[model samples]
Target chain A: MNIKAVVGRNVRRYRELKGISQEELAFDADLHRTYVSGVERGVRNPTVLIVGKLANALGVAPCKLLEYKETS
Target chain B: MNIKAVVGRNVRRYRELKGISQEELAFDADLHRTYVSGVERGVRNPTVLIVGKLANALGVAPCKLLEYKETS
Candidate 1:
């Protein structure tokens, strides 16, 4: 799978795990709701600083956002 | 240490370990030399996609670029 896709999927999964809406997550992360949506949809390329912001909001290590699980 | 600083150190360490200069890494990673320099200086906020590119050039997991080592 593509790296962006992995990042998007992990972001979505972590967001859901936190039980927060996209708007809520965006607010917590100090980002636009549309940016959060774009990230979840794998259409946005988030910078490391942005990733740190989102990870801080999600209460996970920043590296968690880039974890990749390969599928056969 | 700050996240950007950690990232920059890791990138520089990995590049040096690979016996490549920043310019060579930038060339192999298809990034501008100045961009890599900024990253190494902890002044650039590179996107996740850009991290993937650098990691690919360095032949390591993308998360390797984000690893943190706490110094007391």
Candidate 2:
């Protein structure tokens, strides 16, 4: 899979695991809801800082968002 | 401590472990030597794609670049 997809997948997985909506995650990350949506959809190529923000909001390490886990 | 610093340190560590100079890494990653230098110095906020490129050049996972290891 592409790098963007890996990030998007991890973001979605973590957010769902945390039981939070995109709006809540966006608010916590101090980002726009649409922007978070774009990130989760793998259409946004977020900077490392943005990734940091999302990781902070999700209470995970920044590297976690970049991890490519096998979903089976 | 900072995210940028974490990335920079990891990049430098990985690059050095591979016994490659900034110029060689730049050539393999298709980035400028100055930019790679800036990244190693924690002065550049690279995009995730750039991190991916660096990781590719270093033969590591992208998450490895973002990892925050304890430097004791």
Candidate 3:
């Protein structure tokens, strides 16, 4: 799988788990809602700093956002 | 330790281990050198997609970038 796709999937999953909307997450992360949506859709490539902001907003370690279990 | 600091430290370590400069990694990752520098300095937080780009440029799994062994 593409790494971006994996990241997007994980971000979406985490957001849902946290019961937060993209707008809310983006607001908390000090980003645009559209940008957050693009990221969740795998259409935008985010940077390391952006990851930190999102992780902080989500109350998770940035590394936790990268965890994707290998599927057989 | 701050997560951003850990990320920056790890990024610098990996860049050195790969014998690549921040400029080289940024070019390969399709990012700005300044942006990469900021991330490496822990002055910026990266998003998940950015992590994907960096991991791809570094020829590593995105999750590998998140690995920080808990120092006792």
Candidate 2 residue A26 C-alpha distance from true site, Å: 0.5
TM of each candidate vs. truth = 0.93, 0.97, 0.66
lDDT of 3: 0.80
TM-score of the first chain alone, every candidate: 0.94, 0.95, 0.90
TM-score for chain B in model 3: 0.90
Q: State the lDDT of candidate 1 residue by residue for A1-72, as single tens digits.
A: 677777889889999999999999999999999999999899999989988999899999888888886751
Regions more than 4 Å wrong, model 3: B1-5, B12-60, B68-72
Better of 2 and 3 by TM-score: 2
TM-score of chain B of each: 0.94, 0.96, 0.90
The candidate that achieves the highest TM-score relative to the unseen native structure: 2
TM-score of 3: 0.66
Give the winner by DockQ: 2 or 3. 2
Identify the runs in model 1 with alpha carbons over 4 angstroms from their true place: none
**Top candidate when judged by lDDT against the true structure:** 2
Q: Give the TM-score ranking, best first.
A: 2, 1, 3
Error of 2 at B34 (Å): 0.6
Q: Summarize candidate 3's per-residue lDDT along B1-72 as a digit string, tens digits.
A: 666677777778888889999999999999999999988888877766677788788887777776667872
